[model samples]
Every structure is written in C-alpha cells, then in structure tokens.
Target: MKLVPLTDRVVLKQCEAEETTKSGIILASAAQEKPQEALVIAVGPGGVVDGKEVTMQVKEGQKVIYSKYAGTEVKLEGEEYIIVRQNDILAVVE
Candidate 1:
C-alpha cells in the first residue's frame, strides 16, 4: 500500500468481529454494537510540534480501539480502511 497519512493521522485496517455470537445467536450486519477494533497499518510521523516534527507512539501492527464514529473511510486496493489520529485512538490492546 502506498498510503502515507499526513500529520498525526494514522491508517487503520478495521478488524471485523464475528457475525455470530458464541451462544448461537446470529447478529445481523446492521446490529453490530460497535465498530470493529483495528490494527495500525501506516501511521503519520506525528503532527508538527513546536516547529519540529514529532513522532507518533503507535507503530505498525499495533492493535487499537477507537471511537465507533471516528476516522475517514476509504477504499484502497479494493479494501476498506479508516484514517484517524493517534489521539483519537482510545487505547492500545495487548
């Protein structure tokens, strides 16, 4: 992928959770409770800082959970994606 996020923005590949519940309950696509968590794919170097470029704390492949409504959606190479800032990310998953 040739995607290079600008400023502190980061490109995240959303990970889809299972469509079925473990208790044998099937959920419809429209019934999803939250946006799937994601992985850090390509991240911007971080926003400008005091006249200098700051580096982001997030690295590629790191798992993160963000607001369900965050990010700008896009499609690249026929796959969907989301671009959000490092600060927008709520927490890093283990």
Candidate 2:
C-alpha cells in the first residue's frame, strides 16, 4: 500500500542516526540521537486548511529539517515513515 497525505500534511523518511561521534568515538545505540533531517517521501496538496490559505513549498524527494518533536510515526509494509503538517518542516536542505 502507498501513503497519501492529505491537507498540507507531509510524509518523510527520517535519516539514520549517527553511530559514531565526529571525534571518531563509536557510540552505543542508546546514545545515538535521532537526526532531524529526512527525505520527503510524499506531500499533501496545499489549500485552505483551518481557514488559512496554505501553499506547499516543498516537493517530493527533497531533504528537509523539521521540528524536534513533530509528526506521527507510522509503519507500512515494513517501512517506517513520519507524517507531519507542512508547518512542522523547518527548512529544505540544499
């Protein structure tokens, strides 16, 4: 099954957490912090939502940064994804 977001919602696949520190120290799994960066999987059509005229600025396949505590986690066909409102996306990575 495919995921289709609705109403300004965005679907993202989070980037993997770093296993080692920049100083070359390997960290345990429990110490790894989830990365805020992700690749855009799917995007919802932007329109009137909650009386606001919203337009989608991001597109599929773009890498983005989002709020630390945003979106809902979902598992589909053994793959994981996060769904969040467009506003939750902070910036798109070049």
Candidate 3:
C-alpha cells in the first residue's frame, strides 16, 4: 500500500546514519544516532489549517532537515517512514 499525506503533513524516509567514523572504526548500532536528514517521499496539498491558510514549502524528491524529535514513525511494505507536519521540517537541502 502507498502512503498519501493529507493536509500539511509530509512523508519522509530517513537517511541512514553513518556506520563508520572517519577514523575507519565501525560503530555499533547502539552508538549510532538517528539521522536528521531525510528524503521527501510525498507531500500534502496545502489547505486551510487551524483557521489559517497553510502552504507546503517542500516538494516530493527534495531532501530536508527536520527537528530531531519531530514526526511519527511508520512502517510500510517493510520500509520505515516518518509523517510530520511541514512546520516540523526545518529546511530544504539545496
């Protein structure tokens, strides 16, 4: 099944955290931190939210940086994804 975000929500796939350090030492999974970078998979259409008109600034295929603790995690077709409000997205990577 495919995911389609509604309202100002955005669907994202988390970028993998580095498995090794620059020194070439492999880090264990327990030592790895969640990546803040993500790839935009889908975006919701802009509409009125909370009595205010909202516009989506990010688009599908764009790389984005989001708040560390933002969004909800979901699993679809064995792949993980996060669904968050557009406002939670801090910036779009150029």
Worst 10 residues of 3 by lDDT: 26-35
Q: By the lDDT metric, which is better: model 1 or model 3?
A: 3
Judged by whole-model lDDT over C-alpha atoms, candidate 1 comes out at: 0.84
Residue pairs with backbone overlap in model 2: none
C-alpha RMSD in Å of predicted model 2 compared with the true structure: 1.6
Residue range 1-94, candidate 2, lDDT tens digits: 8999999999999987757668999876567678899999999999999999999999999999999999999999999999999999999999
**Shift in Å, residue 43, candidate 2:** 0.4
Model 2: lDDT to the true structure: 0.93
The local distance difference test score of model 3 is 0.92
Candidate 3 vs. truth: CA RMSD?
1.6
lDDT of each residue in 1-94, candidate 1, tens digit only = 6689988889999887657788899787567865658989998877685577777988899999987777999899999889997778999999
Better of 1 and 2 by lDDT: 2
User: Which runs in model 1 stand beyond 4 Å of their true positions?
Assistant: 19-22, 25-31, 47-54
